[model samples]
Target: MMNIRRAKPSDKDFVLDFCMNTFEWGDYVYRVWDRWISDPSGLLLVYDSSNFPSTSKSIPLGIIHIVKCLGDILWLEGLRVNKIHRNKGIATALLKYSLNYGINNGIKESSALVSTNNFPSQKMLEKLGFSKFLEYRYYNINLKKYRDDCNVSIKPDLVFSKKLDIKISQFRDIFSIQEYLSNPEISKFCVSKYFDSWRLYDLNTSLSSLSSFVRNKELLIIVNDIDEIVGIAIVKPSGKISFNGMPMIQISYLNCLNLSIFVRVIHLLLMNYCDVNLFNNAHFLLPVFAELEKILSTKSIENSDRFFLYSKFLDTTSNLSSILPANLQ
Candidate 1:
């Protein structure tokens, strides 16, 4: 028979190896294993054989983690199973365990992101009553590829032209962004309601405990001519490190006034960043906000990957309409 239990420190190596080899997207488990095992607001569970004792300890066949976020949200992540143990109901059992954990812990809801192409995972989430309420697109900008194009000198006419002095500044404090998100106009456009400044604070404060490979990051904000905050982007570093020891920077959480402004800010940011050689490349996670959908729909870029968010509410009265935007007329 199989046994499900909280993962221990000793199980870290096995779990890391299992994740690194079994996953094709990237290996993130090892980066957060230490923190997950010790987190007060998180759980790391493993499925293994305990009834049939072997000469050595039974390795974990599957593993899953759940983190408590702001707004009493339980975010499920890093679900992985050994290839040899596929179709053994391990994933389902793990999900049920997560539900029970949430209920007992007083978390009202849980959510996760699944790749659009990964139908099996989507089906599994749907079977468990989760609803796919939102979609996000992830785009990777190869600084090396854009380096040549961005290296050109500014045009003399443009240099003398009068324009809004839009500038990008790194957010040193989290509360500034928190206050910005509280605006009804901006909050309504956000993809994750629970993702506030407090969440960003928690991320910076708690992520250090997870591993040294991942760096604490900050947000880049765009200020307009009159110094009004217009757009913002998150600069996060992933768990995986390159062969040369540089970690990839995820340039996500992007929200701007318009496509033209976004393109200009991104180009300016990239130009300045490439001069310093911060990372090998950067990724942009695009949420389907108001006009962004139409802007991208008109473009022919095909290199980005898409992911969908599915949320399951433990409270019976809760509805997807509460969190989702109304259909456009």
Candidate 2:
């Protein structure tokens, strides 16, 4: 058995090398880890010379990056064991350590995410005591779907709309990024706990650096009649096509409202996220199973049992699934 340590600054180069070689989507892996590591609450699990039993140097064999949610749940965002070190039980050891850490440290549960095609990793997770959980959607939705002829029902009194008029050149600066927590019923569903101001600003800076990136995006603000930011639709260029006729919304933003209104937000997000014309993520629909076909003309994403799962098990985590919604988009 090899000893493990939390990743340190010294491991940055080695870790980066491992990530580049092992991950099929190095950008995706780096982006997710970068997003989480902004706070010390983020975690990294690494294996040294021991786990491999053969490595002479404590080469970076595997890594697991986690994000904290309400203290109870930890998202195992990035988990990889080097290809050279595969089949040596290193993956299992690192995961077991992390999961035990979560449970022991009062984390109620842990979740691991694998792309739909990564069946091998999924099988490994199952062996480590993780069962398949809810599905999720991820995307930057295509904004070309708004139709002038269509009468989509948004509360006129509470709904607020603004046309993104900034020049495409200013997509990053005056990107018109608006954010508010909604009763996921009224607004679209695309948000996370860490989508705070800092993260948004960071996204602005980072996305700006990736210039020449085609951007058919807008940040739609859902304001109450009083003009307070109540909800937000984080529209972006999904590049993902939905059979429904629009590019998909890669992600959404919502503030869960009262149970009744929450239902509406749920419907809104599902419909928006599911529209295949844009691309859809149906597994994100929890607490409801309104037939995809009944709700939309064509549900683009599959409602699958295999989902990217996370758990919440912190002390202050009571009712995070239901709490005073914050201002996020």
Candidate 3:
């Protein structure tokens, strides 16, 4: 028999051990373990089976986490199962439990990021009704190398502000950001557009739980000659260096209406954010946009990773085609 329960502080070591022993490539669960358990808006569940019992406690057979991204946009991540527990319907049960939890709590849709090479996981998500919506390419760079190669300089005229009228407190920021992104002229500057399901959030719930985990977070907004906000860059902490075996700052979002502005903002991010040495190392993570990639290609940085964003609307009657861009579908 298998039993599932909400993970408590005492179960931290068991959960971390299970993740470390199960995954052979790399592990992100340990990096976010503390945050997941501490986040009030998220749920971390552990699965225990009599089949994997230990002398001290029931060794967890599997684990899953549900993170509330905005309103109805719940991010499912850190799904893992012990080797002895594979092919035994453990993963399916955990997924169903998570989905049901979301539905009972008023979640309308769920989203997840999966590696392109992980076919089994992708198959599982698809079997569970998820659709592959977008693919994001990320580039990882060491600050030491970046400084050595980047000789060109641009003025830091762009202003960084978190006081924009749009607040991400409870999904309100989505509307503000979406309005700017919906502009065809501005959308052209982006490599990929935001998914429709992500834009929709429950109006009744409080999204303030999101602000706790992010550190040194800020919104860098760029203005045009007329002093109007033309572009925005979202910045957040990349967790500890040991989490991914490196220190890096993750630029969650970057948008600009023109190449000149984009170049200026990119330079500013490197000089201001990536210059610090955290955990004895300096590095940064920047998603490779087509325009930025072209400009940085001359600097000899290699593309680090490519992943796909998968989403599933719990509502069977959802008109996803209407919400999603024609090209994305």
Query: Global lDDT of each model?
Result: 0.60, 0.45, 0.58
> What residue runs in model 1 are displaced by over 4 Å at the alpha carbon?
21-26, 51-57, 152-219, 237-244, 289-304, 315-329
Which regions of candidate 2 fall more than 4 Å away from where they truly are?
21-25, 29-38, 140-250, 254-307, 310-329
Between candidates 2 and 3, which one is better according to TM-score?
A: 3
Q: Poorest 10 consecutive residues of model 3 by lDDT? A: 196-205
Clashes of 2: 42
Model 1 lDDT tens row, 229-264: 666666555554331245556654666654456545
Native-to-model Cα distance after best TM-score fit, residue 166 in candidate 1, in Å? 5.3
Two-way lDDT contest, 2 vs 3, winner? 3
Off by over 4 Å in 3: 21-25, 51-57, 151-182, 189-217, 223-230, 238-247, 259-265, 274-303, 316-329
Answer with 1 or 2, whichever has the higher TM-score: 1
TM-score ranking from best to worst? 1, 3, 2
> Model 2: per-residue lDDT, tens digit, 1-329?
34676676666677677667453323344444444444577677677766445567766777877555543466675677777778887777766666656554566666655655677878777765567644443322222232211236434322222311112223433332222232334333332322221111112323442232225444444333454444333444434333234333433333433333443443444444334344433223232222334323332333332235433233433432221212110
lDDT of 3 by residue, 217-252 (tens): 444455545545667665545443342556555555
Question: How many pairs collide in each candidate, listed in order?
Answer: 0, 42, 0
Q: Write down the TM-score for model 3.
A: 0.68
lDDT for model 2, please: 0.45
